[model samples]
Target: MNKKLIIGMILGAILGIFCILGARLRLPDHASFSYLLSFWYNRVILGVIIGLLPSLKSLKLSLLRGLLVGVFVSFAFYSATGFLDLMGFFAGFVYGVIIEFVLFKLNQMEKL
Candidate 1:
């Protein structure tokens, strides 16, 4: 197993747990944060995939993967809060794309 992937997963999980705790504590809800939490977690998970699998580096492939996870998270949030959060779904995609692009740039720099 790749160590970077393992570390990314652990870090993502920790971030997710902290997000939940923070939300429960009423310390600025998810909306108040402008879906950054959702964006970050989505990025972390997808970024790990990008790091581990080169095939997922394409923008189309990354967006598909991000959409799948984002919609799922949105649905989960709706179920838990009884309110749909489409912004989170969109933010997830944005962040996932951002991470992929950044990864692409880093790989390019590695070749230089």
Candidate 2:
């Protein structure tokens, strides 16, 4: 597996864990086990997408790529829930940038 893929997957899973907790805490009544699982998996997919997407020369462009992919991937679940989980949805955007930032840093380090 590519290092970026591994990194993204690991990061995604880590972020997913947090998402599960946040969902549980925020929507205690509505957050079912299956729902949480789906949420986690969705984040993992986001990581996969982030890992697979081509990197750009500009840091800003790369981060924007992450943001767009994050929003696109996250929108599926967001709409599925009828847009009830705003935090979860928005978290996707943040997580996307985080994943990209980590990968970008790694790339920079590699060039040194």
Candidate 3:
């Protein structure tokens, strides 16, 4: 298995778990079992996408790449939910940066 892939998946799962918890708190009345499950799946897919992206020479470029990907990937869910969750859409951008930053650091550490 690819190291980046594994790292991305783990990070994705962790972030997804957090998102689930947060959603539960925020929409306790509206959240259904299937909705939360799919939401978490979306984050996992983001991680997989992040893991598969080729490494960039510039750190800024790498992070930016992630950010873009995040927004793109997150848009699917946002629109699916009828654009009701603006925060979730924006959070995708943050998650993208965080995932990229972590991947960058891990790769850097590997070289040490």
- Give the per-residue lDDT digits (tens) of candidate 1, residues 3-108: 4455445544554554455454543454445454653464466546544655344667655654565455445544554555444445445544454455445545
Provide the RMSD of all predictions against the true structure, rounded to 1 decimal: 6.4, 1.5, 1.5
lDDT of candidate 2 over 1-112, digit per residue (tens): 8888888888899999999999999999999989999999999999988887766678998898889888999999999988999999999999999999888888788731
Report the error of model 3 at residue 42, Å.
0.7
Worst 10 residues of 3 by lDDT: 103-112
| Model 2 ranges with Cα > 4 A deviation | none
Tell me the TM-score of each prediction against the true structure.
0.46, 0.94, 0.94
Ranking by TM-score: 2, 3, 1
Encode model 3's per-residue lDDT on 19-111: one tens digit a residue: 889888888876799878877888898998999887666789989988998999889988998887787788788898899988988878793
Lowest-lDDT window of 10 residues in candidate 2?
103-112
Number of the top candidate by TM-score? 2
The worst-scoring run of ten residues by lDDT in candidate 1 lies at 103-112
Show where candidate 1 strays beyond 4 Å: 1-43, 55-83
